[model samples]
Target: MKVIPTACTAALLAGTAMSSVAQGVYDDALRLDPNSYETLTVTVDGEPMAVRRYEAVYVGNPVAMSATQPARSMGPGGSPASADGQELADLLTYQKMAIYVPEASIEDQSTAMIFAVNNAGWFASELRTSVETGGEYVSTSDTDKVGAALGAGYVFVDVGTRGRGIVAADGTAAGKAPAAIVDAKAAIRFLRLNDDVLPGSAERIVITGTSGGGGLSTAVAASGNASDYFPYLAEIGAAGIDADGASSLNDDVFATIAYCPITSLGYADMAYEWLYQAQRDEQLTGVSLEASQTLRSQYPSYLESLGLVLDDGTPLTADNMTDLLMQIVTQEIQDHIDEGGSVPALGEMFEFTSRGQTVEVENTWLSVVDGQIVPFEIQDFLTFVTQTSALKSVPAFDRTANSGNEGVDGENTLFGPAAQEYSNFTPFGWNMNEVAGDGSGADDTGLKWNEFVETKEGQAIAAQVKLTDPQAFLQGNADSAPYWYIRHGMIDRDTSFAVELALYRAVAGTDGVKDVNFTLPWMTPHSGNYDVQEAYGWLASVLSDAE
Candidate 1:
């Protein structure tokens, strides 16, 4: 076995302590060894395989590690964090990666790599725990993709990232918008820098993540080597930079597999109300109802402004959106039944009965006809969503100081820069209190459109918002991923069905996109990795076609 120096410094090799200044200078350059890996046994689709695991490898230059606040300020349930931030930062593993390679594929540099973006929720205080233990080293969840990749002689890389709400001891927000995606990009670049030494093909990388991580995956797929992120990358001394200070290695991937991505934050509230406005009428009263209607009214103009078209060149308008959504719902149900999967019973709104090789949906979005499920009514689908799921408030993503939603939402914190805890990204949400006296206090507490355009802080937030959105980069100069695999559960109320649909339309309509495998699975919740076989099967076909 070839042993490589863990650090380039000679003093470290001689077992001598170095000065802090020298340590900082040496830490600026990160080096990895091709042979420095541990072998582990893992089960992939019921088959045991020998896999090489590399744990907690830093993706960035940790020159000032002791000065970093690695843990988030807020805890799991909104409590104040008690973790040792210095110790976590000193580990130099916050913006890091854990790589896994199949032993059989160790010598194959052409092996496709899966960059799994670790889910860093609104506030990722739990990431410290993940790093302290070995949780981030090997993911127990998404075994289907990771296991399938290793089983197929492919490499899997777990990319850890910074999430919102991490604060410096000086009261500066360390984790904010673009930080998470930037870290993921740096990790990918690190792999590319060592393409010759690593077991995977950097050019054939595929990214996968769920929810917030899914949003990051989408951003990485869209942004690629876009110039918007160069500053952030340089700040961390990310790998793959040439002497001229330009990015020599690309961060773009071959494909993306995102599940229930909670994205398009700037316009998510409007989309949410547009889908569930009718259902909300029964649930909300007074100020909330007015605010809901106000947001709902904002959706059609925004939808039409997008210039999105169907597969057949017809404009996707509010007049025809329900029919299109119903078509998707029917198709999902039919596909599920065809695959011998039964939808769970939903009281009187939906009831399914299966006999031998046929299934029926009674008084729901679909019904069995000649041993096949067919579209019944759009109202039935809406009713299913209404009865099954509880509706969020008027302004969802950017919470207003309304009756129940008094504090800031996660995305609000995400869009804000250092020390700016909460911000309103949308004008409609910010104008609610002023327009309808809804008592949201958004005008007072949230940043309004005028300020967003006029103030420097707001302008910075605007740029960050664009950086986090995939639509801003979908057709930009940077190369978008050629193959796209996106799935959003039809029953998911986390954001809006419209958000994912917009993303699907954008990616599918792009000229460079080779193939788009998009779906809205029936009865699936706000989740991911639901169909590992199907996802991996699609990936296998794409990889084969690439060859």
Candidate 2:
């Protein structure tokens, strides 16, 4: 039998439990107290909307219990408590979650709960603290995005998650790769545990986020209820895990909404190189030509390995990758033209000229053959690409220590382990180190990719990368959400266009995925919620169909 934790555990999970329960006893009471909320006002569409705000609610006991406490007992999921407790207090701070229920429609809740995954560039974030210290419950921009949901009576939940660059008081990395996603899944389980008292249907959860948050959103959507994450969830004492790492309550979501997600980090570096290798300027980009070409060479096999398919069932290959990308770009241009937006003149579009010779308006970026805009020369398109967006350094992510911007690359920090501050998580990074001898301590002679994977350390990093692999999930390796809404801007430049396209294809090609509404907003940057009405409309349609 499970023990219902004392007020101390209740206080933390429900609101503010500070008193100790029993030694060695897990805080298994993960449900929220419905009465422990105060009505607060949030601005939705410039109107003051009343909402019942439940703040700083811990989803589950992430730390292990002390031996002096009560004897350990099984929780709902029945997994044994075993995670380290050294950073328990601090970890709880990042585990807290907030829920906002519209006061007017609490009795008439929407069909689903919307989990607004916070984006701090995948770095350590404190959502509950931000609200406690007088900041808005959610950002104004976020409010704008979710206003439709709030107005429609959906519960808006913002769950705190740990990320890279956070260290515990014990000098251990508190938030690292997979930690944020783990916290996210735990919060979902917590909501499922308390589904009876929650304002909306916990079974139908929709996750929405942008950029790094978008990446995590994809991770959460893809890896739903997969056994791969069970161990991590069990370590955190999340409410729903059994002896066999099975949970009665599932972590699967109904849908996902991601915008400009910098995802698939394992392939991002290679994709970046493959997309922009021709446009890279060695002196301007500060990356060696050899390093760039070496990384570029590895992309073909990686691209083919995904086995991505076009909507018409054509296999996506490196040879035709440019064709698909061009199709997406030309379609976006044609869409803007149809919307009465004028394409920039050749002079304004191209950033550079060939020896002071201005390019012609016709047959440049686009042509008016028979008075209809058609995609012209690939060179013109490539030129516009170089002109519009700046290229990232060679091997965009997982930069090695000697890769000019060492100690500062976010992706390096992301893939690094707790004790280590930075690491090369990608084969491109590793191979580049070997080729350029950039002082990453790689074998100077040569480091074979297959040999690296055979090592224990390589196996560990591969596991970490697998945790964030959407392709693995979408390709029938795990349960993925049926509905997906993804948006990538035309000029984002954060990652290769191939990244988003690959994700789109993965979802669109999957058997069970009901719908995928993907768009490339013209001239948009790496951002989200630009088309809130359309996004919400899509959400409403899907929810309605689900009913």
Candidate 3:
């Protein structure tokens, strides 16, 4: 295959790698067979910058298969392949492709495309990555399954963005949002270039994903308002025209299905907040609301309440608590922090119970409830935390956070991407004010995003809100075919089909959608894990029906 440089650089800034790819000056690729393969060189500018390896797949099979053995999906080179069933294989695999290197330190617009596949796979449908879960890859991208589906008289293909890693330019990328538009355009282009992908039928497209990937599927399927949400991605790197010689997001996607998808980054904070409490006590899901209020109410107080005690039990008052909180929080968190320009420091503390001196500390601002402890100047505490965190807090945090926040800002607003003017870059949710909202500690993002989709107001502002009520939410926009698919895991004892319940309530609503389709099985993790047979089965079914 070949290396295609895309408009979006995979890497962020110099010191900050948008992804794990180490910046290098050399960028080289190799082409073999119809599908071109590029070798990412490890050097740049006549000198070697650190070169890193990334995993990518390419399929030579036809597009349309819905069922295939997973292990057999890998191509000769271990490039990304497919395992879709055979019926759909003979449809979309064709020559000629357009690829963009979404991001990198090397170059922008270094893009290519050789032979392409309107392929599908039965993998979790998406590859995911996380230090905790390892970099997850989309199993569904496997073309074998797409080819197999072709034999079944169906055609399929996947569109994705951010070629290899992620770029942190925007504030909402936990690795999902930024890549959304790019991937969608790529897939649409793949369809246009191929003879099999119905040139006039963009709405026939079927979108699917699992877990976080599922959320991606839903976002891409975006139905009618595709460009409205991410207008930035309206046109791909090197786009081509369709039968009418006109471009269309309609040829883009017809339907979308995500298995355990997290469609809105705005909701991440709420989800994580609830998740944190749930970890401590399953019944404490309500605590997320409490935490939101707690952080909000206490933030300003901390800003105005910075101080230090003169080695005794007394205290010294200061106006800017930001210094103290920033100092102490950084000290408390160490190496596990997300890199940023100037993160504020407030509502933080350094535990100094070591020296034989004890100090009484009480404040409505911070969470330091321990009566008498150690004594250290608030400013000293901040410096110690931010500077020495890599050494001190890393170990301490790793141990304490066994059940607390990862300090990595998994989804909590406190650590989500920073926002700016071009903020509307992403749709289906928040703005800079919402993401990096008024030092409220964390932005109250995606507030009621899921339900907005079904409302007329939601559709009008589809580019702004992240909502879901496909039927009523879509107002008269939905087809009368009460179609719906419910996926539940018998293995997920987590509230016994919580996803199904949420999906059903969130979509079906009191109005109840017509022609609804639902499926539940003894598979899938408790919302986060879908790495089993159940996941593959769910994807195959969803894609098949959508096709």
Candidate 4:
């Protein structure tokens, strides 16, 4: 066991006193017996928990290339650097992780592990703090849904990640584009590196998360072992080994379970407008009808550009988007009714009488066939969904100005790092004049935009959006997980249904993507991991096939 003092110093200084003590004990044990496995008591949220600790293992920090080492920098192009030729300071965010194995001997256990993440709204500072405390430690209570796994002998590991809204005490933008994804990959590498000492089969790791965390899970699965993220991984000192004269141990997972994932960032706004355009005439707060119309007009071209097709090979176009949505929504309702759940009464068909003009809306997709609404229509479903108001303003995601404050929304903040307050994420939101076309700035929210593409910050912002999106991997430019379980709520207006649909098509349509189980749960909201038993069964099936 070779202990690197510098890496250890970095971890010890960044971590708490209790962590230092635990690392010290683990280091001593490693020195005495290289293959020893030990448990340490660590405090999480002021609660004491017992677990195996592997603290402060350096992966490898990114350094400038010299004549002696020409290949020091790895993964993707456009590696960020300081003018002084020094690498970004390591150890600031390079922390340790704890592992928990079920009650079993280390050598006799081959339990599968869950790499659970806690990220919502793309901000991960809270999660990162939790990891430093004790690696997102889980207890028996966490297995309420998936207790079958633990009861049947499985392991659970929580991962802490850096996200879009983190500013270091020194004001450095530590959590930015590629930062969260890079940390995720590093954590996976750490697990694989210590697979021998850990009780789980390293090859059977399943990634899980909800919302933004779900987006990350999908991204990790889609971009597995791709060299595009290597530079960021190396920057954070991720674990790797030399194999066949090349760096090996890339972060790849066996399967992914993403619930209500907010992905396809580039096309979310268009999808939102296209889906909810029918409600444009209705009075709603924080919504701009003109802005909705403008974005709605642009959706057709974008939808056509994706080249996505249905399972039967029909091109998914704006012309048939309504029908496509109805098909999925109907299935969701039918599934619920089949499970013996009663459908709410919103009337089989209704007439919205507004301003002395009555408009008849037929429940085209759903009807009261045999006195039972087994399937529901899009209009009635949306009426129930938007009963109060629209979830977001026109051009929901990339708001020009922050509706809450003088700044921008979280999605906008996600594009630019924590250093800069916020910037525009999409080109549609780039030129307010173009999106609105009519020269009306009524929908513009006063958000900042990088008008000049030649600027360094502008270029970096564009690159970050491209890198964070999961669609690139689904397109087959990178590796993807063999099995996937993706679910989104039918009424989740946090992101457009188009985003999830596009992702499903990309994964299912692509060659070599073995299995994809996609569903839009009836009447569900922005949530994840609620169906633990079903997920456990899916995990069992995948593992069974592997066996």
lDDT per model, in order?
0.67, 0.67, 0.29, 0.60
User: Over the stretch 227-293, how does candidate 3's per-residue lDDT look in tens digits?
Assistant: 2222223222223322112233232343444444443333323222221222223223353334433
The residue-by-residue lDDT of candidate 4 on 104-156, one tens digit each, is 43454467777776666655522222223233333333324334443445666
CA shift of 496, model 3, Å: 10
Error of 1 at 160 (Å): 1.1
Candidate 2: residue pairs that collide: 11-16, 11-17, 12-17, 22-69, 22-70, 23-68, 23-69, 23-70, 77-241
Per-residue lDDT for 358 in model 3?
35
User: What is the Cα-based lDDT of residue 328 in candidate 2?
Assistant: 80
Which residue segments of model 1 deviate by more than 4 Å?
1-28, 43-48, 55-91, 120-143, 242-245, 342-366, 372-375, 402-404, 432-448
Return the top candidate by lDDT. Answer: 2
State how far residue 335 of model 4 sits from its true place (Å). 1.7
RMSD in order of candidates = 9.0, 10.1, 21.8, 11.9
Tens-digit lDDT track for model 1 on 1-547? 0011223223233543312222222123566776787877655555566778776555454322235454445321222354554445333445767788878898898879988765534443222221121222222234355556666787888665666755544566656777777787887877776788788799988998878878888988988887566556656667754322345567888999888787888888888888887778878988778878888898999888877889999988778887777778777877778888765443334432211123333444555755576546666676666555566666787665443466555466776556556555667655543423332224554645665556765666677778888887885434899989999887667788788888888887776889899888766666677677788888889988989
Clash counts for the predictions, in order: 0, 9, 114, 4
- lDDT comparing candidate 4 with the true structure: 0.60
- Whose lDDT is higher: candidate 2's or candidate 3's? 2
Of candidate 2, the 10-residue stretch with the lowest lDDT total is 70-79
